[model samples]
Target: MPEYNAPLRDLRFVLHEVFDAPGLWARLPALAETVDAATADAILEEAAKVTGGLIAPLNRSGDEEGAQWANGAVSTPRGFRQAYATYIEGGWVGLSGNPQYGGMGMPKMLAVQFEEMLYAAGSSFALYSALSSGACLAIDAHASETLKRTYLPPMYEGRWAGSMCLTEAHAGTDLGIIRTRAEPRADGSYAISGSKIFITGGEQDLTENIIHLVLAKLPDAPAGPKGISLFLVPKIKVGADGSLGERNAVSCGSIEHKMGIKASATCVMNFDGAEGYLIGEENKGLAAMFTMMNYERLSIGIQGIGCAEASYQNAVAYARERIQSRAPGGPQARDKAADPIIVHPDVRRMLLTMKAMTEGGRAFASYVGQQLDLSKFSEDPAEKQAAENLVALLTPIAKAFFTDTGLESTVHGQQVFGGHGYIREWGQEQLVRDVRIAQIYEGTNGIQALDLLGRKVVANGGAALRQFTGEIRAFAAADVPHREALLDAVQRLESTTDWLLQRASENPNEVGAASVEFLHLFGYVAYAWLWSRMARVAASKRAEDEAFYDAKQATADFYFRRLLPRILGLEASIRAGSDPLFGLAAEQF
Candidate 1:
């Protein structure tokens, strides 16, 4: 198995050097006194230590043992409980929760770094808390103050955990057809009766109670999605006095056996007259549920990035140590029978591609985190609205593009290992299987692409897209190394957007057909912009640190020269429109 090390220096580089996150925190009144550069650095260091020393060593072993399901109860792999105990004792679960409820009250920017490290170390262990954080956010944003006081503290203290229960056997992306029912009680709580599938961390021994944010329909409400409502359903119902009461009517029927992240339990939950409390106004559930979904979407996207980082580290280490055929130019290592594989051109191409895309993704994730911070903490109304717009526009792309490229990067890493990658001993195969789910869950990549183009772009008359690309052009105005290349790439995206918008009016299918390609085009351009900004920063600071900055600039150069041109093919595909797609008759197959 491969050893996992936290990318501490690069994480700090993305936070402090590339984005000036500390300066943003200082400017926001809400975060000014909450965190600073020194405090943030200390937090990052400690996060690295916990994840690397404790959690990472369990990745392979946990997969081997997997989560166990017996009768109505589920148990996690060995060491998960102890590791989770140490993890929440550090106040890690509530890192970005509301300060009024015993959370650390840190900005989302810092939480992003910690979450990335957690996923890289052990995805199965990381998911238990990931769902809790998202569920906590939903309850904080919509639940009443009384409910918040009763639920948030114990959850933050790690005595309880949370889950999101939205999917049923019949529904995945479309929620309008769900059959879960919620009946109001005289005590103001509701009785939820239904079953949810694919529930992550639905039942686990790591925490005492599992708080579920469930979606169901009211008996006296209208039909379809408008009638749906959100509820806070707990495994063990909590009394208003802040004490654990009898177990609710919910039970885990079974747990899934899967390809990767086997240590994380995917459950089938049966809620027979389960006690649940209303979250927001009745019949407005979908809107409230999206608040949690958006947060989970970004977190799940980071799962892809974390796996990619682990794969890169493993592949790079092996490339340097694994001996193979001699170099094409000459025998680089005369002392050894065969030269190191790193000396070959094809191997270098694969390694460099992984390096460039993974680092580029790190920068973009931090940038999204910065926007989230601005939208939440900044007092300026215009700045807050701008940040909100960018978040809405970019969140979908982050979920889809990062995972799309993430799968590609992981496959390349596995290919670098040759036949060894196919076996389980090297740990490369686990990463490939684990990262594949990111593209399928939390709204599939296809769903994200549709949301980006259909709702965010074409529906808004390209204003949201222009809002994003305009920022890129503004930054590209600087005299960076790839300034012209980035500007051209942004222009290409703008033109493609215009073409798709015009075609969508004439033929609605154009929107769906052009969506994935359009998103990939936007993703490539966004990375080009970030890579340019990184190259400028690395060049300016090269005098202080030679090797690190030199590597940064070289990777940026490679992204522009080698990877940036791939956007040309995407542009051509988008221009092809939806005619060819509809040519196939429904009965042809």
Candidate 2:
């Protein structure tokens, strides 16, 4: 079985040292009463116990046994039900939920760290609760108070789980083309009739009921996306008095046999005139649903980081114990038959690559989490707007870039393991399979890239990009390690952005053609900025904790020396424009 211990030291460094999260929380009136350094640390410690001691052990067995389907009911792998009960009892699902609705009201910074641990423990298991938290966010943001009072408490208390039902067999990315229909009823509710495919946690035995936030269009609604409406459909109906009623018309027809995350129940749901309460206005469901999607997107991106972190831990442990070939320099361990793989330079390279990317991603996720907290809790108008803008600007990168590098990090970790990595016994291969879905779902990384470069960058005339670069420059003004490298990276990203903008003015497809490469460019530069900050903080504190801070400095150096140069190729590709991409005819291929 694979083992995982949460990086509490690194997490603390990012939270307290790198970001001064306690200070920030104190500054925001809403959070000041709730979280302090001691409380946050205590939460992290308990979370590590749950994640490492409880959930991580179940990952392999869960994947092996998978979820079982019989008739319309789906049962998760063994130990999942008990694990989930323990998990929810800890108030984990409601970590960032509102306090009025049976939640703890913790800041998202803690939630982000907690989410990393949860996903690292088990991706399939994490989805069951993560989806509920996300759906709760949407309902809280846009639903009527009546609906909130009736549904939010049970969902937040973990008596019920939540699922997002948006996709149909006929539609994937194009929600505008979905054929699901909603008919208005005599009272206030609506009758939903449709089939939604690939619904995560759609049907599961872990909870008493599954609440579905479904998207469907009305009869006289417009032809496209604007006509779509959001509905709260439950597997089992609930009364106004918050008591359980009979099973609703909704049922899980079947579950998909998947490539990975086998323990997660991905279901095909059929809603045969299921009674669903309308969420928000009739035609504004997309906007409301985005509340959940945005939350889920970030949560999903962390899935990649968590999986890669698990893989990294496994590979590093194996490298130290497994004696294979001799080191190129000499036999470091003459007592053994062969030197441990840790002495090999190639192995070191792979390990360092994983280290740099994973650490950089952790810091970035924390930074984004801080922004989320600020956007929600800050009273100052300017601060709130600034936080909102950063949230919009970085959400796509957080989702796409983190997962992109996450895959790279995981693959490198597997390479460090060599042949054993490919075997299921080592648990490295399962991580690769699990994280692969992070890139495809929650708006495919490609779509996220386009959203970043096209909508957030070009459509805004690069205002948001300029604001972000300005912040990067403000930080680079400090005398930190590799400051010049970071500045050069920011310049390269800006120039590339300008080039894409000008090209897009002439060729519409330029944005689409260069988006993915452009996103990577932005990602590398953003990490450079973050690593610089971490390096600066680590330098002054090296005396306090030599080993930890020294590792931070070393990883920062490796990232600047090796990984940041990746933008050179991405810039060249972005400047190449869309012309070359269109040369091949559709029929010729």
Candidate 3:
């Protein structure tokens, strides 16, 4: 198995050049004092060391060992406990937590890069961190002040971890179908009774206690998603004095044996009359859960980016070393039996495709990160509103597009490895398996597509799309050297959006059928804008290092010339409408 290394140069470029993250952070009073350029660089450097040195080594072994279950107890692979200890001891779990709760309170923009590195090193290991942060974000945003005071500090300090219990056997995406019930007790708490399947980090030995954010229904609550309520059910109960008390009623019935990310335990949790406290108002669980869902959706997209980077690194290494037939021009390695595979055009195509998508995805993630920061920190109400709207519109795109590209990029990486890619030892197969979940979890990619078209686009009469397109147009209007490519991308995006709006109005099924492709089209154009911005910044720094700038420019050119052209095909598919998808009868087979 190949060792993982963070793409430090690409990360630095995205943070400093593509988005001017430091300048944005400087304007936010909450983050201005702690997250300067030097500090950010230092943090990235340390994160790189931890991820590459500590976590990367465990990727193959964790997959091989997987998680074991015995009599309701789940054990992680060897060194996992120690790695998690290092993670908590280093305070990484709370990198972006509230300062009042013992968190470092770093800006999300800077934290996002760290997140990418973690995912790249080991997707399985990264899940633990993501769940912890997401659960904390939910609790902080909606939980009562007393609950925050009691739970947030310990979670941030990593003395405890968190999990989300949402999916039941019958309820996956459709929360309204859940049968879990929460009976209100006389003491202001509730007794939650139900089972949650596919619960990540539901049971683990890494932390002292696991806090579960569960969704259940009250006896008097309304039906469907609206009737759901959020609860804080800890594995071990805590007293009013903040001391660890008796164990709660929640227990892991068993851990799932998954295809990938075997090291991260997905549990079937049995909440048998678990003592739970409501986090938000009664019958408002789904809305509260969205607080975590929204964060997890973007984080899952980051997971895709992470796995793609891992696959790319390994594939590039293999392509450089594996010798095959002679090059088109001549034998590049005369002493060897044949030229290295890297000399071949097809291999180069695969490698370049992976590089273009991976780099472009990084840039896009940073762009979204900046939007999240602006939404949280900007003082100007209009700026904040715009940022919020863009975040809302782009969230689905970020989640669906990045993961979709991630799977494509990883498969391309595997193709570059030929037979060795299929074998488990090379680690390529693990990348494919681990990335597959990103599309399914945090709401399936199909659902994300529906959200983008139905709710986000047509529901608001294209308000969000128009706002996003306006920003892209502004970027296109800037007098940059890649002005033509930027303008063309903006035009492509506008045309696609207009087409979807018009077509979906005529056919409701069109939105459902065309949603996924439209998202891809949107992603490709957004990435083009990101790459163009990166190229412009790299150009200014060419005097310091010409090769780096040249590589950036080449990748940007590759993205626009080779990758962005796919949008045309997707546009054609969307224009075809729902005929192929919905026209078939259920009994046709």
Q: How accurate is candidate 3 locally (lDDT)?
A: 0.90
Error of 3 at 76 (Å): 0.5
lDDT of 1 by residue, 1-589 (tens): 6988889899999999999999999999999999999999999999999999999999999999999999989989999999999989999999998999989999998998888898889889999999999989999999999999999998888889999999999998988888999999998999999999999999999998999999999998798889889999999978769889999999999998898889999999999999999999999999999999999889988888898999999999999989998999999999999999999999999999999998998888999999999999899999999999999999999899888988898898999999998889898999999889999889999999999999999999999889888888788776878888888899999988988889999998998998999889999999999999889999999999999999999999999999999999999998988898988899996
- Predicted candidate 2 versus true structure: per-residue lDDT over 320-352, tens digit per residue: 999998989888999999999999888888989
By summed lDDT, the worst window of 10 consecutive residues in model 3 runs over 481-490
Q: What is the alpha-carbon lDDT of model 1 when measured against the actual structure?
A: 0.92
Q: Where does candidate 2 have its weakest 10-residue lDDT segment? A: 408-417
Off by over 4 Å in 3: none
Residue 524 of model 3, lDDT score: 84
Q: Between candidates 1 and 3, which one is better according to TM-score?
A: 1
Q: Stretches of candidate 2 above 4 Å error?
A: none
Q: Give stretches of model 1 more than 4 Å off.
A: none
List clashing residue pairs in candidate 1: none
Tens-place lDDT per residue, model 3, 1-589, is 6888888887988898777788888888877897898998999989999999999999899999998888887898999999988878889999989999889988888887898999999998999889999999999999999999999999999989999999999889889989999998999999999999999999988888999999999999888888999999999999988899998888889988788899999999999999999998999989998989999999999998999999999999999999999999998999999999999999988989999988888888888888888898889999999999988999999899999989998999999999999999999998999999999999999999999989999889888888877877887777875678777767777777787788777877888888898888888888877787888888888998899899988887888788888988988888787888756689985
lDDT for residue 99 in candidate 1, whole number 0-100: 90
The per-candidate count of clashes, in order, stands at: 0, 0, 0
TM-score of 1: 0.99
lDDT of each: 0.92, 0.92, 0.90
Tell me the deviation in Å of residue 307 in model 1: 0.2
